[model samples]
Target: MTAVMAPSSSADDMPRPRLLERIGIPRALAWGFLGVLVFMVGDGVESGYLSPYLLEEGVSKERIALLFSVYGATASVAAWFSGALSDLWGPRRVMMLGLALWVVFQTVFLVFALPTVDFPLLLLGYGLRGFGYPLFAYGFLIWVTAVTPRRRLGSAVGWFWFAFTGGLPTLGSLLAGLAVPRAGAYATLWLALGLVVTGGAIALLLVREPTGRARLAPAGERPVATLLGSLAIIWRRPRVGTGALVRAINTTPQFGFLVFLPVFFTDTLGFALSEWLQLLSAMFATNIFFNLIFGVVGDRFGWQRTIAWFGGVGCAVTTLLLYYGTTAAGDNYALAMVLVSLFGATLAGYVPLSALLPSLAPDHKGQALSALNLGAGASTFLGPALVGLLLGPLGVRGVMWTFAVLYLASAVMTVFLRLPDSAATAAHPATDHPATGAPATDHPAA
Candidate 1:
């Protein structure tokens, strides 16, 4: 479908002011996305090997899991407020805060926790770091939403996730694979810490303060509502609420399934570590391509329809096939790799929901975007928690099937997504409200 770019300003209209106009939109967004990527890469460097390292250092498996759970929980709360804070303080200020916290907490972890392997310090340090990337990366996301035109929102959000996923767990894990063997885990961690600080500083310096039409709300009109109330208000919106659920389940496979995938591949299917890593690389490589492709597809087909058919249903089918290929097909690595890639590609459909949420609540883009991120943070904890709990009783096969069903359920939930009247009519004015052959009358002022 043809994308309608931002509304053009006529010569009679005042020219909208811009931040970093010298470099223009492309350069500004590139620097912003790169900043997010570097931070995520730093976060992800530990994804594949962190648990094992803890175990090697004499930390119990249960304690390691507990650390993740705590980090996720902390991140969920941080994710919610981060958006609202961005709206209040402006993205530039909020992002700087997040980056500062990242550096401080990471430094603590490297010094106190890494050397002694102290669990308490690790808990505090890592939990604080959890607040870092969400605020930093998602702060940029809010900046993007504010700046991007309504019609091209899908493309912008898609690219955001492209840089996001491209770094984390995918590229990060790849880096860790190399670094862990050569540099050792502590050194790799130090490297990641250095990168995060450097990336955050550079991105902040490059991005000018947003002004003009790019600003989300009036300078003095910040909402006075409680954070919980703000979140509740966004959740009450039909499209935004449904989008949240869709977002939560959309990443279940990544957080949940991937938790068990490597173990199953190496232990059950008898694949080598490098081979499983290769499979993961292939999946993310395909995901990077499809994320952009489906953004255009959503612009063409409608975002809701793309979510239902492509993301929800497609994830269900591919997940089931991938699981089956792993268990029933018995060591068919070739088939398994194809199914994994298909799963990754299908997931691209949900990327548009990021754009859709902000579009639904233009007036409160921060709250809507926060709701979107809350779903992501919730999935991080809940997906793995559920998998951990179910793995014992249901077995790996059973866990995969359950997540596939959840994907289907999330897709079905999309039926309830009704765009707000304003957004619905903006792009298609004729259908939502029509004029009658009566004299124009103004209602009494409310």
Candidate 2:
């Protein structure tokens, strides 16, 4: 019997050739990401400040956490479905909806901030924001990957993270800190609402309306409905299963360890709100620098190696230093701040995931990306809660170990997730790891 290979998407599938064939950067893609950054600034305003804002309005911690949990739950549902929706509706339309939601969701809070509305309304408001966010991010990533080169996707994703996580959050927190105090909560809310709307308009221009829902159907797969069935066919492969595990496990440090670092400072170390924001500021700054640096590292050393060297082992050591170094009350704060910077810089394996992830299905970039995003979005909640449970018994120290283990798990799973480098000379014996000195012909992503 003659063997048949799954059809692979060629350079022709990319939107950039006609759009920016001459320019090295995809101007539209850059704009799309920038618009996302702007949208996220408004988003961070809510995440970094909204809980505290609610607290100041006299909400209890238990209630706030319950609200947080509800938002997380809604986001989880959105994550599971949004990518599939983008697949059906096209990334541009899905993203536009996300942007529209951000504008309206916050406005809902602004209008409903009255004391009489009660916590359920507040929960509903937060849930809407949460639902909108990952979908927006999902759309943004799809747009970025479609315009970018397959070979350079890792570095492109690095830039995406630099803007997505580093720049936007930094600005968002700053705006929230500066605006909320001076203008009061409603004023800050109005300003963010305007930003989201303006950002969406820019995105609409930047994203270029999708030519069709998701990737143009495989030659004979005329409708997207047929592509949806292919998703099930692809998921049965070992590659998708292993790839999703690599992505989900690797994301824990960022979603799990990083979130709690702030909580650790506030709850265990006793830092005031101002001090916490300042520390977060430092971490975000460092995150931007590392994002650019390690992205290059992934390009040079190979993404899997970077994950093992930086995201994996680096996470363990950096986290432990935070756990063990500070015995006295205030002593923990300075060391924790330093360690948090390290986490921002080194916990960057997630950036390479965009490249590593899409390559998993080789022939199905859309489904692969969706699968990975689904895993990652789900991890946002799972990672935090998994560690949160451990925190009660393990205390700070025990949680550190859990974080370390999670990073280690992320690293080990790399054994199963490999991306074949198209740039590699086909003539070279396929026996070497491109980025690492070590031989990794045996590894999945090698």
Write down the RMSD of all candidates, one decimal each: 6.2, 6.2
Candidate 1, residues 1-446, lDDT tens digits: the string is 00111222321122442443311233345577788888778877777777656777998756766777777776676777667776666677777878888889889888898789889999999877778777788778777765554445577677888878887767887887788778988999998987787778667876553321233434555466535544884546766777787888988667765456767887788877667766776777688778888877876788788989999999999888887777777667788788778987997889878867765665456677889888877777776677678887998888888988999999899887656454644532221111110112211110
Best by lDDT: 1
* Model 2 stretches with alpha carbons more than 4 Å out: 1-24, 209-235, 253-263, 326-334, 420-446
**Measured by TM-score, how close is model 2 to the native structure?**
0.81
Residue 86 of model 2 has an lDDT of 58
lDDT of 1: 0.70
Q: After superposing candidate 1, which stretches have Cα over 4 Å from the reference?
A: 1-27, 212-217, 221-226, 329-333, 420-422, 425-446
| Local distance difference test, each candidate | 0.70, 0.61
